[model samples]
Target: MNITIERAALLRSLGHVQSVVERRNTIPILSNVLLRAGDGELSLAATDMDLEIVETVPATVGRPGGTTAPAHTLFDIVRKLPDGSQVELDIGGDGTILTLRSGRSQFKLSCLPVEDFPQLSSGELKHNFSVAAADLRGLIDRTRFAISTEETRYYLNGIYLHAAKSKMGSLETPVLRAVATDGHRLARVEMPLPDGADAIPGVIIPRKTVTEIRKLVDEAADRIELSLSDNKIRFGFDSVVVTSKLIDGTFPDYERVIPVGNDKVMEVDAKLFAAAVDRVATISTEKSRAVKLSLVRGALTLSATSPESGSATEELEVNYAESPLEIGFNSRYLLDITQQIEGEGAQFTLADAASPTIIRDVADSTALYVLMPMRV
Candidate 1:
């Protein structure tokens, strides 16, 4: 196979495919990317068994054939090449080596049979829908931070996506919601449901798939096409398609964890709240990193203490008319929720010091967060 592709175009496609290739692999073919040249384009594909990414880039094809080459090595070579250089790839008659030439540099890379590369099965997807890039991106960015990293509770290691009836400006509306939690904090964000999405089955998108799709959506100009089955999901946009296996576990009942009748309410500047938590957390012990919030009639005090280090205290004016309440929380968890608030202030509803607290953006009703308080 022989093909000539611009360095910039090749690098862009490589950047998308190579990331799915693990640096260390038990199977030799898994370490290589399948390259197929035909019809004035080059298709590059890489897979890690659970996830597969395929990208097509326009090129001048001299010979139509397919081969596999080291994904990372090829990416590095193209990345270091001079800008606007035309990259030429040729597979030998024996199909054992690939010769890459650009400018004055030439390199021979070991090749593998493309037939050995594993392919992701395109199952019969029961649900198909389209979502704007920005809407999908927003849903992911708002909830992914709360995805659990623990391997034992694999069910909590992804975002729960489903269609539900939610309140949209006092009217019941069908909305697509994303929820993620790590037992410490939870994030829930909802977007208007697209047409034909009502039949979409609920699926837990793994953390890795969420991250990869985010990257693809960032570079995509057209609406993202989504197809989901019981065990897998696929995303297609532009010249790229990503398919991933879903986590085979059930997510917890998140609604029960959310506080319903919390009466005590307080509103504080989101940025100021995040900054105060950051400042007070400096004196907290590394193990705990706990910060205490003391709320009075119209003011809130943030304080942290460590037996070995020191202590810190900061005061912020807030709009609180409820009874006095003292709560302890992990500083990092508080910051994570506050950073997602894009409104003038963050509203917190509390039942007591031990009960979970509800947080919301003052201007956004579609997003809500719940954080479990920590012992200080």
Candidate 2:
């Protein structure tokens, strides 16, 4: 295949596809990206068996054919090339080498037959919907931080996405919720359900897929098209399509973990709370990093102590009118949940020191967090 593509366009497309190619691969073909030139466009595809990304960029095609080249190597070459240079790619006479020419630089890259590349099956998707890019991005950012990294309990290694009835104001409304937990802290965010999404199946979107889709939606204002099957999900937008396999495990019922009827309530500035936690945590031991919260009439005290290091205590004014309560929590976990609060103050409902605590954003009823307390 022979094609002439502007360096800027080619570089952008390569940036999207090459990320799927792993640095080390057991299969040689998995390290290569398939490139096809036809119909005034160049198509780039890369896959690592579990995830596949395809993108198309406008180009001037001299020959209509396809080949596979090292994804990372080609990306590096294009990235280092002079801006605005027209890159020309042509298959050698032997059909085993791809010659790349731009400006005065020329390079011959080893090629593999496009037929040898594995293509992810696009099964009949049972659900398809379009959601605003901002909403989709918010769902990912608010919950992904809580995804578990442990491999043993693979079910908790992803974000649980489903449609549920939620109180959006005073009336019950359909909403899409993303929930993630690591047995220590949980994050849940909801957005208005999209059209044609009523029949969508609840699935666990792998952490990697969430990360990739987040990058795609950054700074994008257009709606993203989403398609889902029993085992796979696809996100399409801006001439790019990302398909990923769903985690084949059942996510634990999260509702039971959320605390209910917790009468002790406290409201504190989100930023102030996080900063106090951070400051007091400095004296905490590396292993525990535990911070203790002491609440009384109208003040909250954050303190941390380590036998070897030192101790710290910080007081902050809050709106709490409950009996005295002392709770110990991992400082990192507290900071993580507090950072997710977009409102001025974070509201916390507590039953006791041992029971889980419920946290919410004062301005957004659609998001909530549950954090399990620790022993100080």
Candidate 3:
């Protein structure tokens, strides 16, 4: 196979496909990316079995054929090449080596059989929908931070995406909910259910897939196409196609964990509260990372203490108190939920010091977080 392509277009697609290939692979073919040139276009594909990404770009195809080459090596070489250079990729006479040439520089890299690369089969997706790239991006940004990295409970490791009844706030009807949790903290964002998306299956999108799709959607033009089946989800936009295997476990019913009838509501300046938590958490025990919230009559006090590092306390005027409450939570979790706020204040509802707390932004009612309390 031989092809000539612009560095920008090649790099853009390579950047998307290469990430799906891991730095280490037990199988030889898994380490290489399949390059297929045909009909005035170049297609790049990479996979680690669980996830696969394919990106296609326009190119001048001198010959129509396919080959497999190291994704990272090719990426590194092209990245270091002269600025704005067009690259020539041609098959060696033996068909076992790939020659890369550009501006007086030439390199021969080992190649593998394209047939050895495993292709993820496309299923007859039951649901097909499109969402604005910006909206999709917001949903990911607001919830991805809470995905669990633990391997034991594997089920909690990815974002739990499904259709849920919008319990409270403006969009009171049923909406699509994106939720993630690591036991200690949780992030949940809701959006108006898309047309024809009401029957989409609920699935846990793996962490890597979430990250890869997020980057794709961010760079994609206009809207992103989403297709879902029983065990797979696909995203395609701007020449890129991503397919991920959905985790095959039921997500715990999240609503039971979200407390209701929490009469004590407090509204405080989000920035001020977050900064205070940051300051106090510095001295808190690293293992615990606990910050205590003391709300009494219209004022809220944020504090954290460590036996070795002393204590910190900062006060902020709040819109609180049907009852006085003291609750302890992970400072990092508090900051994460609060930082997503776009406006001045964060509204938190409490049942007591031990029960879960519901946090919402005053300016936006579409997103909420449920944080478990800690013992201080």
TM-score of each: 0.98, 0.97, 0.97
Q: Give the lDDT of residue 375 in candidate 3.
A: 89
Better TM-score candidate (1, 2): 1
- Which parts of model 3 are misplaced by more than 4 Å? 167-172
Q: Report the Cα lDDT for residue 352, model 1.
A: 93
Model 3 per-residue lDDT tens digits across residues 246-356: 998888877777887788888888898888889879989988999998888988888888998999888888888577778999998888888898888799988988888
Against the true structure, candidate 2 has what lDDT? 0.92
Candidate 2 or 1, higher lDDT:
1
Model 1 RMSD in Å is 1.1
Tens-place lDDT per residue, model 1, 3-120, is 9999999999999999989899999999999999999999999999999999999999999999999999999999999998999999977999999999899999999998798989
Clashing pairs in 2: none
**Best model number under lDDT:** 1
Q: With candidate 1 superimposed using the best TM-score fit, by how many Å does residue 124's alpha carbon deviate from the native?
A: 3.4
Question: What range of 10 consecutive residues in model 2 has the weakest lDDT sum?
Answer: 212-221
TM-score-sorted candidate list, best first: 1, 2, 3
Q: Positional deviation of 184 in candidate 2, in angstroms?
A: 0.9
